[model samples]
Target chain A: MSPKDLEDRLVLAIKRAETQLPDDVVSALEKAHEIEEGSAKVQIEAILLNIKVSRETGAPMCQDTGIQTFFIEAGADFPYLGKLENIITDAVKRASSEVPLRPNTVNPFTGKNPGNNVGRYVPYITWDIVKGEECTIHLMPKGGGSENMCALNMMSPGRGIKGLKRIVVDHIVSCEGKPCPPTVVGVGVGGGADLSLKLGKRSLLRDVGIRHPEPHIAELEEELLELINESGVGPMGVGGKTTALDVHIEYAHRHPASFPIGIAVQCWADRRATVKITKDGRVEVI
Target chain B: MATVKLNTPFDKKDIQNLKVGDTVYITGKMFTARDECHLKMLELHKEGKDIPFKPGDMALFHCGPVVQKKDGEWRIVSAGPTTSIRMEIFEDEFLKTFETRMIIGKGGMADRTLAALEEVGAVYVHYTGGAGALAAKAIKKVTDVYWLDELGVPEAAWILDVEEFGPLTVTMDAHGNSLYVDLRKEIEKNLEKIHAKIENS
Candidate 1:
């Protein structure tokens, strides 16, 4: 496939991610709305309306279009491997103006906005290479409100899984409305600080109700979801039965000395989409 | 809870009567200000220079919007509220100095802002987080913009004309009540129970 073709598809994926709330997230929200009453219900109603409006208008669901992040699962033998980074960068620049994404990238020290989403190390891409003949790209436009609530903790290994649960609950409860509950709490366990956070954010890419393949991890996810909802920081934290739509946990092997936990919170918008490209050059965006 | 429709240049009595949890929809003029704008506004005040608009007569929105310019006119594509607590440091002073009557943002603010709302006869209102398209629908026009070049678009102050612009719930009111504070306490109690359960399990 021509680089332009791939870029165009990438832009389409970004537009889809920005304007449309995915089915799983929308369905979960609908379920929450059903169970909530009073002010909590009002907030969910507004969110549903907002989702509808954005879908109809083709405008971004949120003003903070967020740091454009892409996750790539690339085939080692796929063609155009060397050019993928540049093509993706160009696509982000085009999408910034074409989709009219908010110019979210800023120079930390100078505070200069490029006026396009692209900046140094921005349009942040995470790559995973596997033995396949197809490549898949996922776009997750993470808003600032929830991004600010991300936390990382390095704990003594002796504290165990109970310590991990306490840390997660404490972090979520303290953040309260700040991360824009009913949020999706993504927990990354066992990796180093950065890897743990990355895994935590990666966990958010999973569909709302899907459980981990491992029974133990899935149980932990369910338990954390219930515990978080027990906080009653419903909707935008106005107090209700549903503090979180779901909790997703991803783990990696940890060193005997350290147990690092990374918490990544995603707001109700949960904006994401995927684009798949086969080696045969067939492009599909979902 | 009661739903109230308020016009800008709000009367003190109207602000005072609003209790925490009361829903509000605002009409007339409001200005968008995020972190940079707040710092700039305060800097302008320190320099004894007048800001382009009268903040005293407008609702201050904690927003960094996505705007577009076409045919020599500005249009708001998405204008949802940014988190309000980021502005908590400057809000009390902003209220005292500017006498701004209402604040619209996502995520309720902290103690200083809650106290300032009571003292200044103002209220902190929360728009639904991430509801940018719905927010843009309420904005009628972009009347003026300040510091577009200096602060850049998102951080610039966008003076907008809006009509019935919310489902803005009053989370912090002029009557010394704050729903955020109450929610925090509730969550703290729940956390204790959850921790205990985690330990037992």
Candidate 2:
């Protein structure tokens, strides 16, 4: 397909990711509503209504259209191997204006907003090269509230999994109603600082209620979900039974001396979309 | 437990009457100021320069809304509350200097902020985080904006006309009660039980 075709498809993908709350997240939120009362219930009701209105009107789900984050898996033989980056950048530019995405990127020191959502390395992309002929691109419009709650800790290997739990829970406990409770918690264990955080963020793309393939990791995720919800942080941190709807864990092999843990999160809006481009140039949203 | 519809420029009594957990809907004149504007406001005051608007008894929001221009006019695309804790350091001084009566933000603020709210007879209202579209429906228009060039669009102080603009919960009240502070303590007391269960699982 032409570069413009790819750009247009990416624009639609961004708009969809920005406006539509995924089905699994909505379902999980509905369950939280059933189990909550008072301010918690009220907040959930507003969230549900907000999702409905955003979907119907095609407005953004959150004001913080967030930093556009893309995860791409391209087959080594894909035709646009070298051009994918430029194509995605063009897509982000059009989406920034057409989806009318909130330009959240600003210079860290100067605080200058380029206003186009394209800054040096802004619409950050992560790549994984595989052996297929097709490519899959996933976009997540991550809001700032939950993103602000992300934390990192370097621990003594002696601290073990127990020490790991302490830091992660302590972080979320302080978060309370701040990170938009009933959140989807993402935990990355073992990788160094940056890689751990990356794993934590990427793990959030998994569907709600899904677990790791490994039993131990799945068990850890299940336990944290219950424990976080037990904190009484409830909805909007006002006070209720559920603080988090789910927890996801992703891990990597680590040095015997190093154990770095990372925590990230997504609010109930949990907006993300995926698209597939065929070798024949057909761009289809999956 | 009660619901109140407040018009801005509200006095001490209007704020003090509120208790933690009471829901409020604000109407009338309000202003927007976030990270940059707060710091700038403080700096300007320190330099003996006057602020752009009357903050006394006014409403302030911790938001950076998404706005666009069409026909040479500003339009709101998405406007949602940002986390409030980042502003905690400047909040006490801001509340005292501005004499602000109401704050609408997402996260519950810290002790410093809660204490300042008590002294200034103000309240910290918690709205649903990321519910930008719902909040947008209540915002009728942007009446005026300031500091666009310097602070950029998101960080600029946007004077907005909002009508019945909340189901905002009073997490921190002028009566010296804070839902956040109290709840956190209770959670800490219960943490031992949690630790025992999750210990090495």
Which candidate's lDDT is highest? 1
DockQ of each candidate's interface versus the true one? Answer: 0.81, 0.68
**lDDT of candidate 1?**
0.90
Judged by whole-model lDDT over C-alpha atoms, candidate 2 comes out at 0.86
Alpha-carbon RMSD of each model: 1.4, 2.1
Tens digit per residue, CA lDDT, model 2, A158-212: 9898888888887887887777777888889987888888999999999999999
- Candidate 2 collision pairs: A177-A237, A182-A243
Between which residue pairs do clashes occur in model 1? A181-A235
| lDDT for each residue of candidate 2 in B1-201, tens digit (9 for 90 to 100) | 898998877967988999987889988877889999999999999999998788774689999998888888887777778888889989999999888899999877888888899898899998898889888878888888999988888889998888998879888998778887788778886677778877737
Q: What docking grade does candidate 1 earn?
A: high
**Per-residue alpha-carbon lDDT of candidate 1 for residues B1-201, written as tens digits (9 for 90 to 100):** 899999989999999999888889999999999999999999999999999899999999998889988899999999888888889898999999999999999888888988888889999998988889999999999999999889888789999999999999988899889898787787778777887899898
How would you encode candidate 1's per-residue C-alpha lDDT over A1-286 as one tens digit per residue?
7889999999999999999999999999999999998788889988999999999999898888888898999999879778989998998899999888998888999977787788899889999998977899899988888999999999888898888888998888888777878899999998799989999999999999999999999999999898888878888888898789999999999988999999999999898989899879898999
